[model samples]
Target: MSAPMTPDAALARLRQYGERTSTWSTATYNDGTEKALHGIALTLAAELEQYRALELGTAEGRVSAKCERAEHPVWLRDLDDVRGCPWCELDRVRAELAALPTPPEPQIPTCISCGATGGPLRPTGDRYPSGAQQFVCSTSCTGVTS
Candidate 1:
């Protein structure tokens, strides 16, 4: 058997069937032929819809794979539509993430009055050799017992 006709071709055939049926001027309507034409039109319409859905599904699947590799959110939609597409949303998110500024490394103040490092130190409003504010390891390091 020959391969099935494409949806577009089938749709064209359906249109021609419509034109032929419309030209029928007999009082005795060929009910079978008219019904067959309607059936063919509906079949062509359904075929076109299925074809579109397959295409959209393929595109969305590709986007999902890309999202996975990029460690991005995959909001998958099976519908054959472009409105509010998850792939576009994810691309937007990626752009926003790329534009974000990374936080600076925290500066850990060290005691200038004592040899202790990373201890309970407090700033003394004095600049150390590193230009950072001077800190004392403790009150005892500042010569104060309390």
Candidate 2:
């Protein structure tokens, strides 16, 4: 069997057929050929309309391929389509978390004399030599015994 005719080809053929049949006598109108031609023309017209609709839909889809983020291509109708986007939501969450104040770090007690943070430390009762009430890791740090 022959392949089906494309819309363009069918339209061209139909135009040629119309041109040829225009000169036919009124007696020929009673024959089944004109009726069959009329049916084919109606069917072709419907198919052509469907084909044009599909082509227009494809063009619109291509135009709307990119989202507002611009990070990647997405099947969205417009740039303002962030409500349904996972990437946009993630960015919003990250920004919200970043805007929050961070907790302060804990202060570790260190000996003032030797600047020693680790090991056992004892506080000297007398505020002499360094002035401020100081903690010493060992007796060797200051003359005043710990």
Candidate 3:
């Protein structure tokens, strides 16, 4: 098999995927309207969560035959790898998220309930004082304050 990817390298792949999907929302079917990209965005979000978990020591790291293929070697954290692989630094997580490209269209509003910025948009009955459209990213955010 090919060499295993380092945690940062794996994050890079995820970043590329997210950036590419940002452009996918612009694609149209035979109807000629922009395609809905909720699914793709959700998938990216899930992957991001998974990576975050790995970095936090909340999830098991990669299993290797001789532990040589593991990314972010577990032993580097202590004199004898005491705590196992070190938790992913918060800076690395932020950097990974920042590396993703901005979506081609205007960004959707953050979910009032979860504060998530990217997801399916749900219409809010109220509009801005200027009459511009208003929407929340998650449907479950209905009664929450933005």
Say which candidate scores most in TM-score: 2
Model 2 clashing-pair count: 0
Q: How close is candidate 1 to the true structure, as a TM-score?
A: 0.28
lDDT of 1 by residue, 86-117 (tens): 66677789999979885432266655555455
Q: Least accurate stretch of 10 residues (summed lDDT) in model 2?
A: 57-66
Tens-digit lDDT string for candidate 3 (87-136): 35554678898898753432356553455555676766766445555666
**What are the lDDT scores of the predictions, listed in order?**
0.60, 0.60, 0.53
> Which ranges of candidate 1 are over 4 A from the true structure?
1-7, 25-28, 57-146
User: How much RMSD separates candidate 3 from the native structure?
Assistant: 20.9
lDDT of 2 at 74: 54
The candidate, 2 or 3, that scores higher on TM-score is 2
Error of 3 at 105 (Å): 60
- Model 2 C-alpha lDDT per residue in residues 19-130, reported as the tens digit of each score: 5666555665688767677667767766776666554545344323444777754543433443556666677899999898864322454565666667577876755333
Candidate 1, residue 131: lDDT: 66
